[model samples]
Target: SVDLWKEAAMLVPEYFENTIDIWEECDVHWSPDLEFDQAADPAGAYADLSSDMTKSNSYRSWRKQLRDFIYRDVTLPLWQDETSDLYSTPEETESGFRMRVVQAIREQNDLEVEKLKAKFKSKFESQRDRVLRAEEKVKREEAQYKEKSYMSLVSIGSSILGALMGRKIASQTNVSKGATAIRSASRAAAEKADIQLAEDKLEQEQAKLKELEIEFDAEVEKLEQRIAPDSIKLEEYPIRPRKSDINVADVALLWMPFAIHANGAKEALFTINE
Candidate 1:
């Protein structure tokens, strides 16, 4: 008795018959319990064998003949209705569709980049203006502080010189220390204290300005990072395939039958149509 084995069916596209031309081999498996009566020792026969069809010349010739029949004799039906959505037009070739997809992607990327650049420009200008204003304020304050400090020092020096002169004149005239002399000395000491306080305040103001400058630089650096070319990636935007880009005519499950003999001889029973 000849035992029939069912193999998994292969899915073939009714369209693009040329795509199937690359098949060079086929796998044929025999059942473990099947006995080869033609073998000298039937018990030791190839009960479970997975054979490559191209390994034998007979199998190769048989596969070639079947392939020739498929190419020459087989007739695959296509959709005949002109209004069917499954039918592809001449202008809708794969290459043309690919070019259109690329163009669409490029346009989208350019638009996104322009929007990003505009946003970055606005932020950068705002930050730059803030820094400029802070710089101007600091400069103005420095100039004012320098002028005020110069006048204060001059006045303090003049007051101290007048107090010394008064003391010297009093000593020369043999006059005892009086309230007028004490008042002049007190005023001069107060002026010196005021100068020291002013210098301390100036140092504090300078330090605050330095901190502001550092903060401004950090803000600029952050803005620069946002506008960097590498920061934007095209892969972040994924373009999905459009429905019109894909057209499926038909799907088929084809079963092919093959027989392997005890001496490694193989045969295909029918053409692809079977």
Candidate 2:
């Protein structure tokens, strides 16, 4: 028998249900810097995480294409039709469909054309109401599919989804002295995983920037080794934006929920000012 967790793409709620556990997991009660991914995994605990990361990224890219088709192509025309009430009755819809067919008939007439027209008439007579109901059903399914697919991505990343941009948020003003830390093995693992994820994201970006700088340096070095010194020196490459440009406030606003899921809503903070 397959475990249900296998069916689920991600299992975040299991990790971040308790508020106290998260702080202890990352050892954040002592130091926030300790929550980095390097500190999270004790040995080689996160080894199994790559399969999930690849699935989540690929699914996101695939769903984006599907969303375009459903929203841009199928759903909109039916939605417009519904809003306009353009085909309120089977007769009206059938008549409109007939007019288009007849217009086609006028352009190219033949016995085969008459037979096609008769077939359509017979279909309308037999299933006009059914056709109208099916049209409505198809539109509903398309709308539902689009909504579900967009949400599926969050669940797919079961590790880091705390909440989303459009959803409602809890007020931090109602704080309790109850937000104390916990000390447990499982909780520690969850907090560590959260820290690891953030660190991984940061390092991935840092590595990309570092690679580009190296490539640019290599080219510049080759030019100096070959060309005359009188050659117009290439302008110094502009530095990439420092991680300091990142708005800690903005990041905290976004990352709290992810930490909530990753570390059990443990009062996680991305930045603090004196």
Candidate 3:
């Protein structure tokens, strides 16, 4: 059986009145520890009702319902007023001045973050454009080089064929001399060298393109790291309270087995079948 309770109707109004009174008339600035102590004090309506001394689970259920109401109706309004006057207190204590200075520092940090984001965006775009342009130029040059190499190979083959034909014609006409044969052989060697030189040049260009590709990737990785969400650290002033910090331990036995015999009968039936 689950028991329900409405503590908000019974207790929240009075608690809220006390909280408002404390906020208005109280000159003492409540620290996080003091705030926590007051919230969890057994004298508090919800805390008292939800204490271990309570026999009904209704008290535990009441605690849950009252928590949100108390915070919304009481805590938030008080905190908002406190935060507005946090740095403007007439008494300039060491902690008060420090908080003011911290606020200024955080504002400056916000500006710095904005500047860094803009700078990173500009640099990333410029670098990306440069890399893309360089890649495009390399592609264009590679295509031109390939076409030039094809033409050069064709020219070399034509020259070698023409030389061989001339040598054959001279031999048929009985006009071929040792000098002619040597000149023809020298021309063939020159053509072969030209082809080898074109091949070497092509290889060098390919290597250069590979190096550029590696450099482009490295630069891109560097830019990504600089612009990544984890890379930027924004300054946080004072610590914000976590949900766990606000949690008050529940003391009620919320679940009660009103029909324990039904569960026992099901278990016994399974045991008999086994």
Candidate 4:
């Protein structure tokens, strides 16, 4: 599409060059940027200029030549109607279409990004709650593990003392006390293993929560980049002033000269009152 537009745009300058040649040959002169001459008589000067332009011999010669050229060489083959426009006028065309296109694309991307952000936000929030709960559970388990470990150490010390006292007494009652201490030591060791298992499980859950949070943040950043406004071209087309309502000065200075010199050369079949 861009290549096609470039090719078309290239033809515009070629057409303008041909028109310029005709304009120069006819001694047609004007400028879109021509400022009002402050030193010249503003009132009568315009009238004199208008009369001189319409009465020029060069203007007459070009008008006849160009009419002949268009009817014979250009318009004859197409056989178009007199009312049909040969070329588009600048005023009739729309500007800023490219900017509008860019805006539309940006808007679509923004909407998609918002949707993704909402989805990720919801997921992140849910996972955050889970992480918080897991952290709290881990804290409780750690405290419980500390208490069980301490009890296990005390049980082992008691078993050692009972065994020593039984050996010294050489009696049945001291032996019974030693056996009870051994049973207590075994239960404490089992509780210690359970506590260790709980701590390991807590560590695994915490690691998973950390990983999930990192993943969520990374995805959110990706979505943000996808919707960044800098991704689209924002250059705008230049705007021209509207000329729908023609004033008297415009007719005398700009419109009349242009129509007489350019459009008049074509020997238009119909008059352009508007």
Candidate 5:
């Protein structure tokens, strides 16, 4: 087991040297006092590490890369199936471990996304209903206004004809011209004021309807932007496991080699597992 571990450590630089530029001297250390479980849970370890990482400022630069290494690159003999060889290469274990982590992350992300979509959908439905109701109210009011205006026009015409007939009759009977003029002006002013009031009421209702429609449109646009398939990037989603989801008993602490290099002004770290 010691010889195999040494061989695995030596092979690490060969695979990652171009990308990670490792130091020539590699050290191995183990703590016999610490109790390690027979099998390690990578996802649980990821969750534990994530919780710790968020609380500390350390490893900020290489946090994502570290997580990728644990999920996609790391391979332990304890993690292999009983039917499989005890000493499989990293390449042999990579695909299975990567698939497991990917599936877990994707499932969690999908759940959260569905919840988000449902919330948005509910809001959209509510807004749509409100818009529909407003539209109906506006239509009803418009129809009533048209009907009332038509009746008002007919009444005004009749009133005008009656006033003219009354004036003609009064003039023939030698009634006072001033008195007739005063009565006609009063009725005309009252009718004009009623028509203006009705028009103002209709205009207010129309304005309210327009405002509602605008709000509905805005809601639709927001929903589209939020729940669009193309707009969702799985990589961007925070699909990490919660602290409570991880069991401390399942975690194993292991020391792995990491290479630090300067890329322009920024420093980056890369790691490989044995």
Candidate 6:
């Protein structure tokens, strides 16, 4: 097969550097004995392989040979619109390859959680501080109230003392007027006391009258007792004898006639019978 790569390079030497690199990477992947690079794309690897491009003179010559062979024998059959495995390897990340990506995602979530925790911590501290400040303010207000209440009580006490002192000074300064008022007050008090005393005297007089009335009644009762009749016993009266009307002469004379007739008749009858 004719190597059109060399002819194409001769015609367009400006693209030789890139085309030569593509050839080098493909020769390394698919060795001389193998007919096809069915599994590897050296063109794709040329863009990303880790190699010192400056020291690849011998590698470049061998790559040119493989490139010439591939362009004439294989690539000429494929169109410009068609994709080839030799030019492109699919970019795929297996589950085994995803370890780094998962690590990055987990790190991001951890960072977000840490930030949220920090934000919440800050908010909590702010709220706690507000509560503490409010408590302090309440304590301050309570202290002020207690102080005010104490001051008010002291002022009231002072006012009362001042009033009492003023009254005493006025009373002492105007002796004549105060004396008259005092006498009037004393008179009123005395009247109340006199009323109480009079009530006591009246109660004592009533008690004496009650005692005299009780004594008079007792004396009257004694007089009545003396005039009342005494009770007599029934045994003190003699029992009356019962009188019968039958006389002793009536009984004896009546029985004496019968006695005389009975004796005479019996003696005559007996003398006849004998």
- Which one is best on lDDT? 4
lDDT of 5 by residue, 1-274 (tens): 3122212122222222233422222232222233335554453322123343343333343344343443343333423322111223333454454344444445655676576667566666665565566666556656655665566555655555665877664453334444554555555555556556656665666666566657656655554453433443322111233333322222123433233336634232333333
List, in order, the clash count of every candidate structure.
Answer: 0, 5, 0, 0, 0, 0
Report, for every candidate in turn, its global Cα lDDT versus the true structure: 0.44, 0.34, 0.42, 0.45, 0.43, 0.38
What TM-score goes with each of the models?
0.32, 0.16, 0.27, 0.41, 0.33, 0.23
Deviation (Å) of 175 in candidate 5: 14
lDDT of 2 by residue, 152-271 (tens): 443434312222332323323111111211213334445445555555555555555566556645644543442232332222222222332322211110122223346555544344
Compare candidates 1 and 3 on TM-score and give the better one.
1
Say which prediction, candidate 2 or candidate 6, comes out ahead on lDDT: 6
For candidate 2, which ten residues in a row score worst on lDDT?
A: 2-11
Total clashes for model 1: 0
lDDT of 5 at 55: 36
Sorted on TM-score, best first, the list reads 4, 5, 1, 3, 6, 2
RMSD of each: 16.8, 49.8, 18.4, 13.8, 18.5, 76.4
Among residues 3 or more apart in sequence or in different chains, the pairs in candidate 5 whose N, CA or C atoms overlap within 3 Å are none
lDDT of 3: 0.42
Tens-digit lDDT string for candidate 1 (1-274): 1122222222322223223442223222222232222323333333332243224644454446444533443322222121112232332454443444444444555666566666566655655565565556556555655665565556556555665777664453323334444455565555556556555655665565566556656655554444333442222111222333222222222333446689988675444322
Ranking by lDDT: 4, 1, 5, 3, 6, 2
Candidate 4 root-mean-square deviation in Å: 13.8
User: Residue by residue across 211-245, what tens digits does model 4's lDDT show?
Assistant: 87788668666655543434433322333222332
Relative to the true structure, candidate 1 reaches a TM of: 0.32
Q: Which candidate do you rate higher for TM-score, 3 or 5?
A: 5
